[model samples]
Target: MPSPEETVKLVQQSMAVYVKPREQAEHVRRVIAYHLQSTVEGSRPGGPLCLIDASANISEPYQGIRGATQEFFKASAANSKALEEFETVRKAHTQLNQPAGPVIKPNRYEILDDKLHLINQQEKSARLGTLERHIDILSEKPATNPDFLSLKPIFKDLRPLVKVPREIVDSLAMDENADRRDLASLVEKLDKVLLKSKLLLTREEQYLQTLKSQISLDPRSVTPSAKARALDTTRNELINWIESELSKASTNADDSDAGHDSDSSHGPSTSGEKPGEEDEVAKKTRQTIMTKLGTVKESYQLYVAARKSLVAALKEPVSMSARPVAEPPVRQPQESPATTEGSSGTASYLLLPYLSKLSELTAAQKAVIAYKSHFNVALAKQLKEACQIIDHLVPESQLLPQFPWPASERAKHLNPGSLDHLTAAVSDQPDLSSQIKPWVFASDSARIATMETVAESIEDGQVGIESINKTLTEIASLFGEVNGDSASISQGDPWADLALDLGLLGPKPRP
Candidate 1:
């Protein structure tokens, strides 16, 4: 039995001698670096000698070189002055060995041989053939790189190999069997393998779920070629369904309209009416009348409602205190005498037929009219009182001159000249005189009443000078002032002569 140090040295010696191929040297260097960083001495059952190879073709090699390397590393310690020269020599050697181009590639056979060597080293300590078989299966490549078909068998072998580490092996003979003595090792190895398998399965399941989800959401389905046809069919089906629903909705809407028409045509029967006895033609005529009446009522109500709303909207309260006091009412031009004469002519012409109708009235009608005379007398008295109040408020000085009265151009046909002659002609007949008298008196009474009211306001001295100035200002704003540059006329003051000329009273004398 060789010592562990001696075994490592012999292995390194065999590698350097018989396996002196270019690729072999590179692989040995990498393996050496890996073991130096990883393997602990005397930790495993076989100690450091477990990582060695002993085949019948190769002679037993010593592990003294590994021991020497370890010794060399320890010799160059900190605070040792001689170690600096050794480091310099080591660095120079590493620089000289560095290749100029990329690292050399290893042959496939060399790589396989290296893997076999690793397997042989592991097998020396324990029968780990399952692991070796797994590596062999992974290493074989088919002609076409073995598409998806080759994955099944590889996965099946890998699944079993992952469990081999948990198999109990005899400590002395290294036989595969669970023994109480190796139970702790078996459990630890089992735990590690199970944990690795669990992690792998978890990642695989996540990957599978992602693949399945991607396939389901694919717009092209599983077959990319059918994508265009599928889209067209889906669009046509949606349009057909929409058209069908629209037709059904339109049919329902028409039925609803028919029901509404029937209800409207069969207007509600009155209290005593029976449905069957009602004539269809008469019912239609009644419906038409009711519809017209309803339309008229609706229009009239709308007009009333709109007028009320407008009146309410415009009824803004005026602040009496803020407003200047009311001035005497200004009188406007009266209708000319010629206008009155023309009005009499037009009135007589229009009333001729009414006078003819009055004569046809029975004597009983005239007797009934006389019976209502007291009511007409009371109305006349009330009118006279209103006229008195209006006459007291206005004054003559504020009145406008009577001129420019309106008369129809056609009035000349009734009277070529002398309006008095035309008036007398209309007044000659008793029936015509009675009819035209009221119209003539109504027109003259309005003018005389206006004149009387203006005369009363002037007598009461209620005329507003500010009102006159405001009126003058408004006129000036529209037509500009008579003399804007005059020395007496300020920015907004009225013309001094305007009040006198317009017959407006001058400013009230100061108290």
Candidate 2:
């Protein structure tokens, strides 16, 4: 049992905790007494009663007395319980069970949290003064809304893939140059250019979302399933705006006229443009967003791959003692990755090849996206060029292992069929020329599946079908060994033509 002395401390604290309410009650009494001042005379010069005499109270010091009729007047037990809890906690800290010396633990907001939750519930249930009920379309962003885009919230990482703009992924498809450092340089010059494409894109997305939100207020605006839509800034911003509008819309009636007026004013222009066209615009918006994201992602991947390779090269690799005597190093004036080795027999400066191939792959991805979105005559040529570069890189890329069969049958299985190094570090990564992203594409994937089916359906070429099936099942497979450049193969003798297709040797064949 807590003693009377501890109860006294509880009473003191209880009075202090409710000092504000006491003062407020005193003010109310003074206002009432002034109104009734002439009705009654005090027994003494100034004595306390329904008629509050301020002069009488000023004559004596404050006694920390509370009125007998207050809600807190009977809270002694509760206050005593709280005081014991504090004392126990303090004793735990001291480990000596001593009396607590003024333990000050303000409420940790659990009660405040409950009150806030109640307020949110009330807001959601509150009827709007406007045509909007809590159930109305104007009362936006309900959990059950079908239009809601299920984008995972983007939280920036602690150690993000840094030192590159996010939009380089878009440039990967568009940039003709194998070196993507130029794209980096362009991004570096942000805000210096007046009214650039970046500003236009930002403004267009804003206006587009504004238009869509207005259209959605109407019941007829049925949209396609947003399930396939990837995470994007426009969708994120649109969701945030809806939440803000809903929060502001409450039981207040005056806000109804304001919202109605704004909608009426904008209705003409909004209706002027058909709502169905907005999806196409949204598709473009997502693509724009994807480009920036893809660029950042592809750039980071390239950075990681290059960084890993460079780190490995900096280390002393063991002698290739098991292989044929390794080729001698050819020193370049400036360090180049083309050189096989250093005087120390360790690899040197391996970031260049990855950087080059990464840019080429990005270009190919961009081409694919462009062709898929809305194919044009210009994109056809772009795709061809990108495909050629990809073909050239496939053989040269140390990222890929050498073909199993060496040059002709003479050197067959004698060679290691790969560069000296085919480490797990390389195997873990996807193809250097992998696609980043684009608008929804079914043609290529569907076409590939169709081709496989057609190939399997050919019962006459059973042996060929089995061979093709085996090759298809392999992780990476190709038709045949392509020897020499296209030009060399085309112009030279049939034997000299190597397996490579020569542009000069043939007119275009029908697809």
Predicted model with the maximum lDDT: 1
1-511: candidate 2 lDDT, tens digit per residue: 4676996686578557544576897896675455445334432326554433222323232356444322222343344545565667566545644555876666869879989999988876663533455456545656565545444333433455566666776766665756766776686344223223444455568879999988745544533222212222233334334434634543232355456556656666778765446545655665675577556545544543454344444353468667454343333322332222231122113334665899999899667645543443344346557667767755665433422222453233223463312421333322222321110123344556679888877764898778886776552324334434422334434544233345244443223
lDDT of 1 by residue, 1-511 (tens): 5566875685566445334588975785566555655545534333342233222222224355566345423332321323344456558756766788899788999999999999889877465677777677877755436565676766875645544333343334554655555788888567545544554566568879999988756655555335533443343344334445745765775566567557645745434455444456556655675577556545544543443343333454445567454443232223222323443455546656776887777566556544544444455446556555445533441332232223452244245475655654533312333233334545576688888898887766545666787788788755534553532344355553345455675674233
Best-fitting candidate, scored by TM-score: 1
Q: In candidate 1, residue 100 scores what lDDT?
A: 81
Worst 10 residues of 2 by lDDT: 431-440
Worst 10 residues of 1 by lDDT: 330-339
- Residue 76 lDDT in candidate 2: 38
TM-score of 2: 0.12
Per-model CA lDDT versus the true structure: 0.51, 0.47
